[model samples]
Target: KLSPPLPLPPLPPKPIPKPRPLPPPSFLSAVHQGNNDWWRYLMAVGLIGSVFFVLTAALSTLALGLGWISLAPDGSVTIRDPLVSYLLSHLPFGFLGLGLWWAVVGLHHRPCRTLIRACGSLRWGRMAQGAAIWLALIISPLAVALLLNPGSLMPQVDWNQWLRLLGLAMVLTPMQIAVEELFFRGYLLQASGLLTQKPWILCLVNGILFMIVHLDNPETGYGLGWLALYYAGFGIFTTWITLRDQGLELALGMHAANNGFVILLVSYGDAVVETPALFSATSFDAAGVVLAFAVRALGFCALFFGIPGLRRDSVPPLQPQGSASEKPPGS
Candidate 1:
């Protein structure tokens, strides 16, 4: 009996289940994926940087040859023909690089249709927005004059230089504006939006970076406080329009016209580059510049926010929400 009882003691073992695999990435998820292809982004930056350098070198060479821009014995690059120098220096690479990048990115990645649809595609609404922005530019300088110092509004320029500057401004303004819009509102804004899934954050970040780039302007003399505030404010206004309208048409139009007027109409003695028209005043008095900024701000607000037709139908689409591990490509 004891032997039989001892034989009855057999035990069973427990079984273990296998671990599950991680989910694939979604479109939005992939955008935030810590730049899995860091090399590509770096390459893009390098390519763009190289284009700028090459353009600068080419312009310098041309200037030296033409006697437009000269390196003096004292090491200053003086421009005998500023208008020609400006045109040669800026036009080739200013907007072209950005245009090329957009074309390449759009073709290669095939972004969502929602991203590419211009304000005009939304119908007549975009045109109104564009008009409003243009009006703001027209009114800005004048308003600044009225509010601050009317005398400062007048530009002083030699008649010949003014004509030359005006012509150059006409040629260069579009390119300058296009470069800004494509890079800030288009590329940087869109990319940031997709990554953060927050439209406001994207806009603000773009604006901040945009402002930072202007810090080195010889005109500003590296005055961090004034320049920073001025650019930040400018960026905020522009970003608001880009976000509110869901396209860059208004921003582009406004920027083009803004710089056009500045180059053609507003002139200052110490301006980094000479244009045809010069402001009567040699420098921006604090009150005068503030007034100018205010006018520009108000104009932007009125054109984009005041007008009924210009309002966008939808906020630009943000990156779809989800964990990176669970998302798919190009979502």
Candidate 2:
């Protein structure tokens, strides 16, 4: 009986397995497999640059407003012309900030081949999308003005005003758009993605930051509630294009063209900003502005989502987790 019990016990011996090691942390994985550090440095430089650039812009604008800088009797800041004034006043310092940051990033890091390739592949489509957005913005304001006051479109224009307006459209608008894109799409979005490894979080944060920057605009009566809604909507649409298209090309093109066209078509009166746009005499109250924003929102949805290539799935899928070394398709 004892021997039989011993045999039964020997049959029940179990095997022991060695424990497996855990995977590396995500931050270490990013450093090892991805170029996250490069993006982080780039973002740091951009943040510093933005602060300086904004301070410069504010001081300059204040100087101009306070008559420290010379102005014409018409309350217009005088430089070479409206176009030159806008460029000199607004463009250079901001661009310098962006340029410096880019230079630093380029020097320290390997180029982001994926982003560059994405930009190249979708260039033409972006152009078309941008043109459509610009057209909508241009037509909407004019249509509203015309509907409200039929004779608003036929406003008289002097030659100097035309040159100033043209400059506004050609130079200042693009400059403003570039500054915004460089900060939001190029710097903030890129940095957030690299840091968090989550695209949607980046989109949300960037959109909110963007709207916050517009808080001081006099047009919204400093109303944070209305301004937040307006900017959030605009940011969501722009961010959608950035994510869906896998780059900022479409957003950049659309923003540049929108600013250019708006400056060209909408006149707010004796404003020294360069643009060939003549403003309607009729005042747009809160309701009219809200309506304009609604139209813009609807139009953005139609232009971006309605297009075949601009759909969410149409863009290249984001790189799979733990596969940062894998080159994106078509990259």
Candidate 3:
């Protein structure tokens, strides 16, 4: 061997691999498992509308004939028993739920659970956490309001009526909330995602649609603009959370709690879903209501995102379930 072998040249530096891009959030990407033709969505919409209209008209006629509901000269509706009215108002949602299932599962051939969560199941624990957070945010302000103006607390129902209302609310309120969550945040939001990947864009469009849906609500009397903004804001908030969590459980829980509180604890004049609430406000405070909403929205986001273990989507990348009729694109 040669006395002096040249030292081996220094090895070249290894190339750093570029990080793989992350997949879209499961709540949006869930749509990939199904056929996404525009006409299919239109069919789903038509089905939902037809189902809702038929159910509402039939129920209204029956309620009027039964003397359970009355119409005033100005077209204001009065329900004889708030509990029965709640049932009437919420019953359509049960049918609508079926229509939605048919739309997502039957028409689109997508797994139904994908409409609710990426994991193909409902996370009851996540829902309960969301409910607790919403309750705390709402109750805090109500407590403060009562302390400031005790006179505003006018009792609206006896304990017996409240007990009955509670029972009905425990059943009907969640049903109503689930349908809404499934439609707007689940179906509509995913549809919108097909066109854009921007979170803000998705949230903005969802908000506008939600506002339009609520345009006919009795709360519009507070000021059409204010109510519109309020409804839109709620949509944005819920949609944002849905995107963040990659599921509808949090939204469902929060919505259920909000409606339950209004229906069972406190209500005001011109409420859409009349209930035998424990207390009624003599005057509507539109500004205060909006402010409280803003506060709650901020608190909810901060707490949910900042706290460990509060996020549901932190586990793993979304995996399409075998139940999907079509294999997801690029899988």
| Winner by lDDT | 3
- Model 1, span 1-331: residue lDDT tens: 3455456665776667777754322222323423325465556566666777776777678768877766879898777665775677567657355544644353334332223233113333454456456655565445654577555455465888787676666667666766766666755665565557565676578778887877765556524466566666667666666666556666766666556655666645545455655554444543345456666667666655666674343443333344400000000
**Residue range 1-331, candidate 3, lDDT tens digits:** 6598889999999999999877444777788889999899999999888888888899889989998989999999877787787788788888898889889997899997788875578889989989899988888867776788787778866888888878877887888888888989988888888888778888889999988878888767877776677788889999888877788989988888888778887777777776778877677766656667887889898788865666444544323323200000000
Candidates 2 and 3 compared: the better one by TM-score is 3
For candidate 1, give the lDDT: 0.56
- Residue 239 error for model 2, in Å? 0.9
Error of 2 at 188 (Å): 1.1
Which pairs clash in model 2? 165-275, 165-276, 168-274, 264-277, 267-279
Task: Write down the TM-score of every candidate.
Answer: 0.70, 0.65, 0.84
Runs off by more than 4 Å, candidate 3: 1-25, 71-78, 308-331
Candidates, ranked, lDDT: 3, 1, 2
Each model's total of backbone clashes = 16, 5, 0
Off by over 4 Å in 2: 1-35, 38-43, 46-85, 92-108, 112-122, 137-141, 151-156, 197-200, 222-224, 269-276, 307-331
Q: Show model 1 residue runs off by greater than 4 Å.
A: 1-38, 95-99, 102-150, 153-161, 286-291, 307-331
The Cα error of candidate 1 at residue 165, in Å, is 3.3
Cα error of candidate 2 at position 68, Å: 7.7
